[model samples]
Target: MTRAFLLAATACLISQAAFAHAFLDRASPAVGSEVAGSPPALDLTYTEPVEPLFSTIQVTDASGGRVDQGTPKPLDGGHVLSVALKPLLPGVYTVEWHVTSVDTHKTEGHFTFTVKR
Candidate 1:
């Protein structure tokens, strides 16, 4: 009985750990999407609440020029990060982000979107 209880507890802990990390749930422009016009801002949504003070995002043009206005700001209780953008011309933009979840887990990723003429 003790062994069975220990196994159940171990499984529960492992399952919880699997979801403890903050992962990118979705984003505006929808990762690798192409838009007809420039979006006013880039919005990133995560699976867990993140700490804005410990997060960063960068949007760069195809030529590798930074296009994001500045640092990111949190929204929806830190489940989302919004980054303002400069007026973007027709081109591909890369967004790179690194965020720390409220649980203190760090996650980072990058995606690209294109603006059609």
Candidate 2:
């Protein structure tokens, strides 16, 4: 009975890891980085492929004004998300993202990057 319990526990742990929520793996312009100039767009990479239909990315300046051009677009089979940006002035920009992985797990996060004067 003890052996069966241990096996069941192990299987539970394995399943949890296998169906883990998707998280940010990387970002273009690099998270918390200062760029010499404005990037025309933003790229976000995730640990797993996400469902674009249920995912979102929003960008805002320090003043809380939305700067992202419009809806986010998924690329690279949904592992990467790209969003267009309006002309950015020298300042801090915050990017907020929420994604639902193909596995049906959902997660969200935010980061900031700066443009040099």
Window of ten residues with lowest summed lDDT in model 2: 15-24
Candidate 2 lDDT, 1-117, residue by residue in tens: 999999999999998886688899999979999999889999999999999889999999999999999788889998999999999999999999999999899999999999999
Deviating ranges (above 4 Å) for candidate 2: 1-19
**How much does each candidate deviate from the true structure in C-alpha RMSD?**
1.1, 2.3
lDDT of candidate 1 over 26-92, digit per residue (tens): 9998999999998999999999999999999999999999999978989998899999999999999
Model 2 C-alpha lDDT versus the unseen true structure:
0.93
RMSD of 2: 2.3
RMSD value for candidate 1: 1.1
Clashing pairs in 2: none
Which has the greatest lDDT? Answer: 1
Candidate 2 has what TM-score? 0.87
Candidate 1 has a TM-score of 0.94
User: How much lDDT does each candidate structure score?
Assistant: 0.94, 0.93
Error of 1 at 54 (Å): 0.7
Winner by TM-score: 1
